[model samples]
Target: MIKGLFETHINVSNYEKSSSFYEKLLNIIPLYEDRVRKSKFYWVGKPGESMLGIRENYPSPLVQRQHFAFRVDVEDIIHANDYLKALGIESTNFYGDSPEELMVFPFMPAVSIYFDDPDGHSIELIAMLNDEPRTELEIMSWKDWNQLHTK
Candidate 1:
């Protein structure tokens, strides 16, 4: 019954600020907004592929933050660091290494980078690589992953 993820929600301290940050970074236009409740929703990709909801109901410190990722094209993942840099967003490896340290996961055979939204939630842009999983490779930089495949 479940083919894929359809929707997910996260908490942000302020609706307007969080919405604006997402709008500028992701270039998303929310489909719905509740002014009184301070809630906003946006389609992460195609209208029905997935929905991302941002709620500004996090008034107390007890509210736990969240993390989410958007699947993108491999090319997009490769260039995301530069794109994020231009927007003044710092991208990093899982280890908090350099921004150029794009990541490759052998288990999932995917490439991705890590960054943060205004609310400090870990945001990732990932793309499945067109390769078989080599569990022995473990996790490493994208460049290293490619070199091994070439050899």
Candidate 2:
């Protein structure tokens, strides 16, 4: 049985840039910042809970584009979207079908919005806030971005 995910680490070329971007996106302060190896780690949740790290290490000084996602409350999804927009960051619709898009295979209890970091690594922010019992398929079903886009 899987216990839970502790944190995710992604390699990048620019440490400062990536660190700033993630800090803005996650809206959480970093737990630690190591200067010896040019690496910056941040806490995704409350202190002592869990954390994510962004290490500066590109293949050839180029941007490292990988794929990753984070889980959020369903009610907070809109706020997240707004936050991103306010920062001038644009996220691609998942699946690309109509206004609704599919980000990835059936992740349960949430929906994902596709995006990328400075290095072009694919990133996703998943929102989970449904009161009703949900199946992986149901929660992962195609979502109408148009509906969410409207006021």
Candidate 3:
């Protein structure tokens, strides 16, 4: 049976630029690179863990965009927003709302913020607010989430 996600591949126009972006975003250098491939590629993150592979696009043109999320500390989500802002990056809510807004799923008790990469890929930083098990999925505004938490 399959265990878990090992790695994910993202196609990019330039390996160098994409690798550099990941290096800064992940705060870690690539773990491996293969110059032998027709289209250059590099791997980031630790071995056995969920890693990311960025590959240089060949003759194929990028037709569709992609979206992915990273699980982060509850507190870090806020800090990450500020960090991205400092880097001149803007974030948005799940609904593509204000940059200052955060999205909350009441059932999951999770909060999240989203931003786009240079290639226009949607990236998200999400944090779980509670340890309770989720029985259903529910989306709500930040205001509603906060109100529920305050009760």
For residues 5-58, write the lDDT of model 3, one tens digit per residue. 666677777677666666666434467787654233333345456677666664
lDDT of each: 0.83, 0.65, 0.70
Go through the candidates in order and give the C-alpha RMSD of each one to the true structure: 1.6, 5.0, 2.8
Residue 126, model 2: lDDT of 74
lDDT of 2 by residue, 74-141 (tens): 65555655667787777765664322344323334356677678888887777654433334343244
TM-score of each: 0.92, 0.73, 0.80
Question: Between which residue pairs do clashes occur in model 2?
Answer: 65-121, 66-121, 74-128, 94-101, 94-102, 95-102
Which runs in model 2 stand beyond 4 Å of their true positions? 58-64, 96-109, 129-151
On residues 63-116, what C-alpha lDDT tens digit does candidate 1 reach at each position?
475778889999888788999998888889877898687879899899888899
lDDT of 2: 0.65
Which TM-score value belongs to model 2?
Answer: 0.73
TM-score of candidate 3 against the unseen true structure: 0.80
Candidates 1 and 3 compared: the better one by lDDT is 1
Q: State which candidate has the highest TM-score.
A: 1
lDDT of 2 at 31: 78
Candidate 1: where are CA atoms >4 Å away?
58-61
Clashes of each: 0, 6, 0
